[model samples]
Target: MHLTVLSRSPAIYTTRRLVEAARERGHRPRVVDPLEVELGLGERPALYHRHRRFPRTDVVVPRIGLSVTQYGLAVVNQFELLGVPSINGAKGIAASRNKMRCLQTLARKGVQVPNTVMASDASKLRQLVKHVGGVPVLVKLLSSSDKGGVMICETLESLEAALEAILGLGQNILVQQYLRGQDLRALVVGGRVVAAMRRRARVGRFARSLAQGAKFERAGLAPAQERAALETARIVGLDVCAVDLLDADGAPLVFEVNSSPGIRDAEEVCGVDVAAEVIAWAEARFEAPPRARATAARRVPREA
Candidate 1:
């Protein structure tokens, strides 16, 4: 089988791991930057990369980054239009990219999530904070990734300052209840929790992202936690993703759903062959009959 990985660079840890995994499984793998993919439209939609028509691909695995979301989604959509199945579809990726949208979808699907509110009026900032449980609330850009546009405001003054800085730049933001407890990340693949980790923020910092110097250790998820993580991915319409949950009292409250989750940390901490699992899942779909494959492709939610 031939697998195509949509990524900015083949040097990226996750991309490299996937390439290695595919090759180990006796499959040909190619990494293409979504930005470099040229979409052609006519009687038949097509894609061209590096000035040549893209070759037939058995399956696509998108490692789209937050910075290139729009173009990346377009590239993924083009693949779908051409009947090329992808592990994660364009709608799922788009939904996960927008933090608020992801939370809303999960909550609507009866999954628990942190109390979050979005508004454009700065005059109602205090009310918005109160709605989410008050100061020390989280201020987040609607479409941030890797903890880029997230802020912890411990006071009204700070909340106001953060809001001004974000909204003044014309970016949408969400105010969420800041629940203090265990910070957990679960990597879900094909409706199963394949790896889990507990993350601790660096001393003197509130963010618990590995990129922010956070330390993580292998962790086991409670049945409920595992269920929530699985449900979050399904609700967001992704076959593979990472769900971030914060323990609120004894219950877990999902805070984020990452579509293109980085597997390096989870793989290292959990000692799981996450890349291989991802490849295997894609291979299964690739091996399905044409009718079954189309059915599976349509199972992934389409952008409305």
Candidate 2:
């Protein structure tokens, strides 16, 4: 099988690992920068890269980054038009990128998520804060990656300042209830929890991103936590994803569902070849019979 990985660079940790894993499994693998792909439309849609027609591909694994989401998704959509199946489809990727949409989809499917609210008017900022449980609430851009667009407002003054800066840039934001508990991430592949980790924020910090000097370690998930992670992926229509949740009290409250989750840290901490698991799932999916594939598609719950 010829597997194509949609990534900006082959040197990226996850992308490189996937390429190696595919080769190890006896499949030809190639990395294509989505930005370099030319989409052709006519009687039959086609794609070209480097002034040549794109070669035949059996399946695509998208490692789309937040910075190139729009063009990246377009490239993925073009592959779909050409009758190529992607591990995570365009719709799923799009839904996951939009924080509000991802949470709404999961909540509608009966998954508990942090109380979140979004508004355009700054005049209602205080009300929004109260709605999400009050100050110390989380302020996040609707389309953020990691901790780049996240902020914890401990006071109304800080919240107002953060909102002004973000809204001034014309970016939508979400005000979410803050849960003081363990930050956990579960990597789901093919409806199963492949790996799990707990991210601890650095001293005096609120966001638990590795980029923010957070520490992570391999963690085991309870039955309920595992179920929530798997269900979040299925509801979002992603074949593989990472579900980030807070151990709110004794229950799991999902905060984010990452479509193109970075597997480097998870692999190191959990001692799992996450890239290989992802590739194996894609291979099995691609080789499934038509009836089986149809049934699998039907199993994905629709968003409200």
Candidate 3:
């Protein structure tokens, strides 16, 4: 099978691991920056790489960065038009990339999430924060990734200032109830929770971000949390993703569903062959609908 990985940083661990995994499985793989892939539209939609028409692709693994999400998704859509399947489809990526929309979708699907509220009117910012159970609130931009636009405000004055800064930049924000507890990053592939880890923030830090000196360790998830992660992935239309859960008082609340989650963290902490599993899933997924190939065992059984 011929596979293509859509990514900007091919030298990165995740991209390199995926390339190696695919080659080990006897599949031809190449990593291409999505920004460089050119699209041709008309009666015949097509994609070109470096001025040359791309060859037939059996599967595409999109690791679209937030910076080029729109263009990356357009490239993926072109592949879909050519009948090539992607691990996480373009629609899924779009949905997951928009933090505000993702949270609203999950809540509408009866999934547990942080108490979140978004306000387009800056005048209502205070009320929005209050609606999410008051100050000491968590604020995040709708399209921020990797903790780029996240902050915590402990006082009303701070909250107002934060809102002013965000609104000044012409970005929308979501104010969420500050759920304080351990952070669980659950990696779900093909509708299953493959691995989970507890992300511990650095001393005196409340943000459990992998980029901010947070360390990961293997962790066990309760049955409900496992189910929630799986369901969240399904709802977001992601075949492979990482669902972030906050263990707030023994209850798990979904905070984010990342369509293009890094596999390195899960691999490093859990010792799981994440890249290999992804390649295997892609191989099987190329042959049939993902749902048809998915097994019942991937789901946690419900007790009567």
Distance (Å) between predicted and true CA of 284, model 2? 0.6
Compose the digit string of candidate 2's lDDT tens values, residues 116-153: 89976645667888897886677776656545787766
TM-score, cand. 3: 0.85
Query: How do the residues 51-104 of candidate 1 rate in per-residue lDDT, one tens digit apiece?
Result: 677765779999998888899999999888877889999999988887776777
In model 2, how large is the Cα lDDT of residue 111? 98
Q: Give the whole-model CA lDDT for all candidates, comma-separated.
A: 0.81, 0.80, 0.80
Q: Candidate 2: where are CA atoms >4 Å away? A: 122-127, 143-147, 153-167, 203-211, 288-304
RMSD of 3: 8.0
Ranking by TM-score: 1, 2, 3
Please tell me which predicted candidate would have the highest lDDT against the true structure: 1
Worst 10 residues of 3 by lDDT: 295-304
Residue 265 displacement in candidate 2 (angstroms): 1.1
lDDT of 3 by residue, 1-304 (tens): 7788999988989999999999999998989899888888887676778777675567899999888888999998887776677899999999998888888899899998988888666567788887988866677776565466777665667676676666666567777876433778899988778899997654432432234566888999999899999999999999999999888887888988888888887998899999999999998777866563232212211112
Q: Give the local distance difference test score of model 1.
A: 0.81
